[model samples]
Target: MKEFLGTLGQTTARAYGEDLIDFSRWFEESDGIELVAGLVTTLDLRDYLSHMLTVRGLKPSTINRRLAAIRAWLQWAKRKGAINDLPVFPRHLSEPKRAPKSLDRVEEARFLRSVAREGNVRDNAAIGLMLYAGLRVSEAVSTKPSDIEIGERKGKVIVRNGKGMKRREVPINADGRGMIGPWLAKANSDYLFPGSVGGHLSPRTIQELIKKYAYQAQLDPNSVTPHVLRHTFATKILRSGVDIVTVAALLGHSRIDTTAIYTQPSWRDLERAVDGREGGNGE
Candidate 1:
């Protein structure tokens, strides 16, 4: 199992390993059964799900995540011939829909101002990719200097290491190009954002940089992560009347459903809609 997991990306491998350990402990301690991949059955997994929901009080979303990890590991084991048959996953429990968190326009302006005040050229460039191009932190750090093409009006950024090891090109709006220009001029390394050890900056380092500026800017510190910036990009672009399919393409999302989550209107938008209707009727 350990050797198989070693083939995955570092973050994914760590998470899958943790999920496996949790299931193994539950299989032995709760089921009092020897946990072997081939010998496990659908009934056993069903029981495990029941235990997680009833005793462990795990939410449907969490259980779904665990099931995904376990399923991937089991499939790998089966391919290696370590397991004869894969255990069937229980029917997934439905999770409530929650809108992705993103900063409103007012908050976004304040955040950018804070970044300009507290951050360097590199920081601004990094934030620009997330804010405009919807690049994930991992993808942003993995970007090479050669990946960007910033023209006066339009440009594109190539995400070298996107999710699932895929690559895609995203357009960099004028604002993004302007934000990235200074760093691109002075960039010394092959990487867009070089790390101390001579490669791209670590995701944690990028995250910490954003967190620092977020605090100085007086925004909600908790909401200043790289992912929130991504959500902001997606949400803002979608609200700007871009089609969901186009938004998904820009975000490098494999499925349109993932991008549809951004369509949920915010309270401000709902209020505006209501006010517009009432004003039109001269009420």
Candidate 2:
């Protein structure tokens, strides 16, 4: 099912595949296991949850994700008359909530300086592309010169296989072109940001570079990442009042809804917005 296939997009899918397959295998082995219809009951769902929690020792987030996948598959099946109903989702099976992450400007500036300090024009461009262009790590890694059109006034980075493997063109300005120029010339390839041997940089290496900066900056390793740098880029751009749609397009989001999450205010921004409200004061 496409629901099962969609998991491939997640970072943990490779590791989680065995567990998911095992779950399917176990379902087939169980008595009265009509895999499609009979298993749509709460009793059946709870029993599976118990198996995952007790036998597999899976986290709530992991369990919930698998459950969500199962639900999607069942929904698809039901629509096609292969099943009757959706399995009731366990209310208690919920992920631990946490705030989204980003870097402050000072820390970001230090990180940028470190990249530039490498004196590898490629490194400079890689970090610059993330920070200035607000690109996802994977997008930065997969960039090709052919995917980009560099001109004097309005340049563009064409993300061919973006988050959902969708393509879109992201317009840029002279500053972006200037930032990318040095790396583009030295590299001989269709790839704008080539990898270590030859291709775009690996996600692991980009992550390692971020770790290196976090250590050098004396900041918590959790506080920094290639994605966070991208978020920082969008955050800075949004704070500067570049519209959300613009940031969404620049971030290569397929939907403006996906990009709106980046516009969540920093504490400082939120406080200012709250304080500046003109609603009547309490007596």
Candidate 3:
């Protein structure tokens, strides 16, 4: 598996490595099942999927990803004559149709106020990038001083470690400038958000800090995550008449189909649409 993964890109390799490691651990612990590919059957794969869904409580997307990774490994092993009989891959579970989580205007205002009051320079800057620039947490943390170009009038965030290793520059708006400016002035390390011990801030640390800020803002901590901030950024801009292509570019999405998910109307939006059409005194 490692050898097969080695031929892939860094991001893909790392994800497959983690997925294989998890599968190995589960295989070791599961009763009456050895880790050998030849010994595993289609039923065993189904059981593994069941374990992921029931025991691990993984979401459909995550479960599908794990299954895909394992299937790839099994296919490679079979082709290499390592395993004569390969188990059938488990069918992917259908993802539920649900609207993406995003902050409403009121919640966004409250969140901004909370950050101003309770957050430090780095906290403000990190939130700014994800909320305004549509950056992933990993992209924000891995950003270096050289990756940013902030001027008085305009600025851009040079995303180096974006998803799928795709690099892009995201323009920063007025709000982003205000938040990142103070942080940049005080930064002494190579990274934008330096860690206490050494490298850039870990994603887990950022998650915890966001949770703290959410509590301070009187918002639901579970709903306010870095990705939710990104969603909020995209949804707000899209609502304000930004073209989907531009939004997709800013968000570093390779496919417009992926970005189209944000086009789904919120319940509040649907309510407004219906309210606008209601008869009003017969004009």
Candidate 4:
């Protein structure tokens, strides 16, 4: 397991390690078997899947992630001659398709108002980048003052390290400029949002910050996250008739299909459509 994890990047290794640990615990507790790569059978994998779905009631995505980790480890073991023959892995469980969650107009207004009311310039600026410019939390934290360029009539935020290390420029409008300008003027560190230890603020800190203001705004803190803010930005932009190609670029998505998901009607939109239909409601 250590050798397998060593081949992966640090972040990926940490996640795969956690998944492997859970699988190891389950292997010991359920079947009284040590988690050796060669000794594991197809039945063991099936039983693990059954346990996750029926006993633990974990989401398909969660189950698949763990399964993927195990599959990768097994493949690695086979290459190193630790296992001679591979077990036939079960097909991954199908995950339900749902639109990514985003704040409604009311929720956005309430949340932003709450932040504006008491949040420091740093907080407001960080949140604004996600809500307006569609920055991922990591991208927002890693951003430097030099990455942002605000002109009299136009501006853009350059995300140097987006998902998959792909770089893209997100245009900033008046609202984004207003929120970010104050902080940029006052920022002293290389990071736009500096941490206590003198590096960028961790993504976890930004998530917690969103939760804090969500609670203050009388919204469910669990429902409000930095990703939700990014979703809100994407949804709003798509609804305003922005082209999918453009939106994909703004969100740093390599595929147009990823951006197309925002075009799917939200629950609220469906509800409004049904509510406004003529003569069908009385039936």
Which residue pairs clash in candidate 4?
Answer: none
The full ranking of all candidates by lDDT, starting with the best, is 4, 3, 1, 2
TM of each candidate vs. truth: 0.64, 0.58, 0.64, 0.67
lDDT for 128 (candidate 4):
86
What lDDT would candidate 1 get against the real structure?
Answer: 0.86
Give the per-residue lDDT digits (tens) of candidate 1, residues 29-146.
8668877777667887898889889988999988998988889988988888898877668988997565688888888988999988764888999999999899999999888888
Top candidate by lDDT:
4
Q: Comparing candidate 3 with candidate 4, which one achieves the higher lDDT?
A: 4
Per-prediction tally of clashes: 0, 1, 0, 0
Q: Comparing 1 and 4 by lDDT, which wins?
A: 4
Model 2 misses residue 210 by how many Å?
Answer: 2.2
The model with the greater TM-score, 1 or 4, is: 4
Candidate order by TM-score, decreasing, is 4, 3, 1, 2
* Tens digit per residue, CA lDDT, model 3, 164-245: 9999999999889999988988878989899989999999998988898899899999889999999999999999999999
Distance from true location, Cα of 215 in model 4, Å: 0.7
Candidate 1 has a TM-score of: 0.64
Task: Please give the lDDT score at residue 108 for candidate 2.
Answer: 72
